[model samples]
Target: MKKILIPIWLLGLAAGCQEAPVEASFAASETAVRFVGAGPAATRTVVEADGTEISVVWGSDDVIGIFGRGATAGNNYPYAAAPERNEPSQCTFASTDMDKIFKWNRGEQAFYAYYPYAEDADAEPNALPVVLPTQQMQNGPGSTEHLAGLGVMKAAPVTRVFSEEDPAPVGFTFRNLFAMVEIRLKMAPGTAVDVPVRRIRLLSEAAPLTIGAGTVDLTAPVADDPLDITDGKKEAVLVFGEQPVLNKTDYQSFWLMLAPGRHPEGTLALEVTAIDNSTCTTTLPAVAFKANCNYRQDAALSLDEFVPAEAFNATAAVTECRVGEPVVFALSGEAETVDFYSGEKFHQWEYADKDRLEYSDVFFSFRAQMQGGAQLHPLTVKVSTDFDGTFEEPNILTAAWTDVTTRFTLPTKPWTANNGPNTLERYLEEGRMISSGEVNLSAYYDEKSPYLYVAFFYHVDKYDATLKNSRPGIWFTDIMAVRAEGDTRIPILSQTKETVHIVNGDKYAEGEAGSDWQGTPYEYNGTTISPLRMWCVNNPPGDRDAYAVTNKLERKVSNFGPDKPESVKGGGNGDAPRLQLRVCGTGNLRNRTGGPEQDAHRRNGNGLPLYGDGKTLRS
Candidate 1:
């Protein structure tokens, strides 16, 4: 079962309007918390953050619950249940919201903030309903851990995401933290993004701005951490910190969130190296390129040690690609051999679709050939929702120009909720759903989750010719999976618009246990070749026109919710919609090469996982 939580603000075309400071004061004096973080041992030990020793747990390490806990019953039973509802709760390894605490950062003296994730992965096109904490928390120690009271403190807006290019007022102080510091924050296309960062100053002042308790201005020393980000148009990280400078050198990024207006007193004089004035130039790499050659992998994870030269590699999920431009993809590194095989675009389903769903019909086609004396595999491609009544497409190997411009038909059939057919919901172009008022699902892409493939599906209709195009025409590959390199991909479900897809939020790390380390496999089928079947039963293309379509996402059933039917909606409106789709057979993805873990494995084009005696990719 696949599990993902989509922050409402992180989804939709326009972000949930910049979060204004909540005025409802949550009295901190009324809060008290008995913190207990579980670990790898059976003994539930108490932690310093909470100052308690009730129960210490290990191995089953997990943030049990926050907010409140149930009390006991009998006076001496020692197992009494508390009565009092504590709605919404949080369990995170990122963000200053201690509720979302990950592994504690010993060095920084803060929570290992997992924050959100910028995503681009192989996931289903379904947004599970947002489930907030309703079960009353056990009123105990943790009731006081949160910065409750003072109402939701108004967050200081981004200081200077985008300022006059030249003579941008910048300065630097010192803090040895931050293993990686970036200058520019990349923004999704169209969406207005701003650049927000901490103030870096070398000079100290007597007077400083007091933003919040425990958090002061330059008046004293730097106390703020993690920099804030504005909308789009942020400075890019030209330098990833070559050497540890702070303890010895004179460099540091500001930590406080600066308010609008100009420089505050005592906080003027910015540094140059700390600011990145680099312009985004389309130099068209010295060599031809592929947009998304590096297949989608887990974010918050590392290939080799860190990641591929680039994290996500998808051509279909890009917003800045120039039409006819040569998009290049650099997956981990070196393919053993171009196997020219089969691939699974979809995976098994958790929730059944009774009331069929809808989606955009996208066609994929590519070819591999030698280039620059290196086994260069340039698989240029393009896509469109143009699903003409026609079915199978012709070979794209014989192209006139080397670019991603191959076109095909689209699914124009009228969208029927649950006509016993597998297909995608059309852009209704009306109110309530995909309408003229607010933006549709597509609008959220590129800008929100910049690099990701949005899949579409409808019910399986035997009578509809379009439904029987390939497999069970019900499901189809609408777009390839992808997301911005910086954002972490998260799955979400929306009923207001009847839409679902992956969204890019912040950055994250995949669990070492859940990493795709076994690698992948591939094989030969007569003249037709393909990859090892991980998610589907393989059926060689009977001909260039025959292929199988499968949902490759590892979906989670628990995500459907309690009201969901015991069985997935197989043929009704209450059931979840399903898609029947296949991959284009013109590429080497079919017969993929072998991996250290048997099946074809993906290598880090950028080599990480820290080679030599490594355990999984975690090695």
Candidate 2:
């Protein structure tokens, strides 16, 4: 994903070698050897020059190593061109001592020449030794001064008649023995604007160049064999004397000379270092270089964004939490972006491992009690995979619910003292508020859905409510669900009073149906009265009060108002509030009343029905 495409142009390295006009005649007194480039037929094209032709003229300090089959065979015949004459591609050369100029030998003479003269080379021109510099310095684009020591060029042998009849200088056309690469670097598309690039290094374990002294056989055909590099190098660093800001629209060219060969794929990596010392690297494609070829590699360097690892810090509030639990965390330091990891098997940091079919076991827990003569079981836990987020009764009734009530235990007898023995009172004295033990709810979990709706249906048939005993009110507390993973238990869905909400599920208006109230004994005695309900709070000391859904559900002695022994009110022990549910009417009290009538209960987190005013809940 971090890679970008770069176009490259490969062409032959062209150093215009042309023949000059022959002179009328040579003076007998002038015994100097004159030289000119080969004819136009051997000329190569230049890709980035002022014109279509590019010429390499001799420098003031330039010298060429020549070998003549006659007297110059045992010792090198160094030829120095005058500064004035060196301005042109064709020039006349003389020995270090002007008096000892090159002289014509007897018979048909044979001669050879090479430039960037190497002192370590043997006197024999057939096998000359040369070495290239590994460190290259560039002044600016199109500059070739650094190529003087790195570029190796050799001219073909020239055989001509040395008679007075011939006055024209013998010409030798030079051909580069190695390849040249013109790297035109520019900012990649979408890269940061104006990145001050300080340096770029080309690295390859394949040893792309032969930097050590090597022997080149001039006798053999140039293309017949490759250069014999005695010692090769794996990397080359190009240092820009002037630090330039990279531009996305234009490219800056830098040239390098390398021994020609096939560089394998993934063998070359370009490391670009910015002015701030940050660096990024990209691999180059495979390429085969040939002698005398100029590979103009246009690379769009990519440095999308750089962030140091030391600039980030994140701390979690707790080491572990249950599934669906609100895990708190504190983030510090800086970053361009951040992603959360749930620490689950499939939900890892890796992009590919984000989904799975397996899921952990879930459990539901709650405490319940029934008063009066509630003959029919009231609480039934049902699950729905698809539940639209709304309090509309039609929407809840239309949703498909799978009855999972058989999974948990339900109370079989009433707990009020008038109805039966005070079974709920005896349990409350022991601090065992959560009477119904945790029940496994894995059967309702659907991996395909993000949330599972669990609804507690508290309803009684109106036909069986003729006697006050038939309308027994049910109580529920500590209602919650959690995920079980080995020994660890993760909170799946839990809510407090602040998060619970109540909505109109029937024809009645919103606030009128689900309002909290204190029910009087007369209300419960009425045969046609609706179900009486109220909120109460009285949690025991040194308990998990925060985890309890409701503090208490049974009416205390303080709630009795000098009425029948069975009378109930909505006030807990003197200080805390209490709630009581009583049936007083003959109308149907079912959650779904067959037609459009439904219960008025709003849903909280994870699609669970709640019993508070319609408002956002705080878990």
Candidate 3:
């Protein structure tokens, strides 16, 4: 048996329009042709029709495609109510387009009509090319404009006999072609009640929302059976006009239109996306949607466990640099607030392992050997509190450097050579290592500066080929700086490649202490190597045993103990040494007991880790 679904609105067939019951109603007129209601009245008022409350009214620009009997095509004729019809009550419809007027002939004729008139939509009056749009717009509450976009309705055929002197009203038994869904959403028990909802999607694999472009066979027998939506989409989205906030006390209503079908249990769900781009889903029970019927679904949405992935990210240009040099950090992402842990004395992420209240003393240790030159003043240690990160010469010369060279012991003469002066290969071994006792650096620690720079000024006063004052080759190894509080030594710096920025400055002229080195470029085995101010790890250019520069500052044997250096290979491209400052070890830094890390990973909080450049350390 086929269920005859009635229309939810009515159009009065008489001049003095009045409300009628759900059953069929008819009226007759002498001059003008009118449409009567066979199902429900079309008005803006919330009227009970067929045991459902709906408000459907005739708009001012309504049009209908009407087909006369024995004709294959239909004419699109516009219809509207009277000029004074404004209230939510029954009204009559008359032709609005002057050129497309519909008249009856003196014979028995049957007429077929469909709402939402289109010009090219013509078939055998059975297979009308009806397309349901996927994206539906929302106007407001109780506004049928959203439903008007996807709603398709057709009237049952009506037969009448017309004469020149006598005219009668035509009644239509209109029926809807699709099903309706009304969703009522509320906040879950622990969810925030004020989060705004952006969109809601209805998903079901067994029951699709819409079919591809196809013809609707209006001549089908049954109206309640599942519509043929074999090739259709699995999801239908409903966008809200005003992103309404959720409340636990009341429910917000949203409407959607989809194909009429039966959705299997456990395959239907509603996903809601909030304004913050977080999503929440709730399952819907099994349901069978019939044509011309609206199903109301009530569900709760919880946003408590949804954490947006694009919250915050940070990356430093250079992870470790000299103290006076600037630290450039590039930050991105969106957040309500952000905190930057500088890893300085008191601003470290590991607060428990912060620097002591008052440092007892600051000192440095180094191993160096001076070879070739009679003058032992080629190397000096200096400290500055105002040097930027730029490696230019004028910037370095303008900065005030405090001479701290006298605080440490430097090598005075060349180590005992195993062979001649030009072939003294024993300097590359660990036996010639000269240890500089712990030198005080407490006077240069400025409390106002965020960083301090310690530079090793290695320069030759004059390059004399006669060996009178020629630049001596100097090698430094196992260099370290620390802060002492009683017996607790906190490492302030080390010589590692990643911790130092080395520049040879100019490789041409040398006279003043800060001038570019003018050491001659010598050819060695076809490669021209410049031996000027080279801060390299292996031997300097030309392989002269007296002036070959090398360093084992990056030796990995022990923290602060004298160990054999790595076997020295003779090349200028060998890895140079670097030093890092003020490293602290934290046992349980990211404590799960409290703070932002714990709060971010708390219950119902998605455990989103704070993303940053992994090169940065807390201490």
Tell me the deviation in Å of residue 147 in model 1.
17
Per-residue alpha-carbon lDDT of candidate 1 for residues 1-619, written as tens digits (9 for 90 to 100): 1112111111111111112221221111112211212111111111112212111112122221111111311110011112113311111111224433222111211111010111221121111011111111112222211111110111121112222222321111112111111111122223232322111221112221111212111112222232222221111111221221221111122111121122234332222121121122211101110110101111110111211111111111122232223223222221212111112121111111232222332222211111111111111222222222122222111212122222322322323343211111222122212111211233222322222222221111122233232322112221223221123443232111122222111111222111011222222232111111011111212211112212221211112221121121111111112211222211112211122232222222232111111011100
Highest TM-score model number: 2
> Each prediction's TM-score against the native?
0.13, 0.43, 0.42
> Per-residue lDDT for 280 in model 3?
70
Off by over 4 Å in 1: 1-584, 588-619
Ranking by TM-score: 2, 3, 1
lDDT of 3 by residue, 508-591 (tens): 224323212224434435433232232221222322211111121111111222211111121111122221222221111122
Q: Quote model 2's TM-score.
A: 0.43
Off by over 4 Å in 2: 13-32, 39-55, 71-74, 82-87, 98-100, 119-123, 224-226, 305-619
List the lowest-lDDT window of 10 residues for candidate 2: 539-548
* Model 3, residue 353: C-alpha shift (Å): 47
lDDT score, candidate 2, position 435 = 60
Which regions of candidate 3 are displaced past 4 Å? Answer: 1-34, 42-52, 71-74, 81-89, 140-145, 163-167, 217-222, 225-231, 305-619
Candidate 2 structure quality by residue, lDDT tens digits, 421-514: 1233433443323367787756665555545666655443332324434334455544566766667777655433432223233433334323
Assess candidate 3 and give its TM-score to the true structure: 0.42
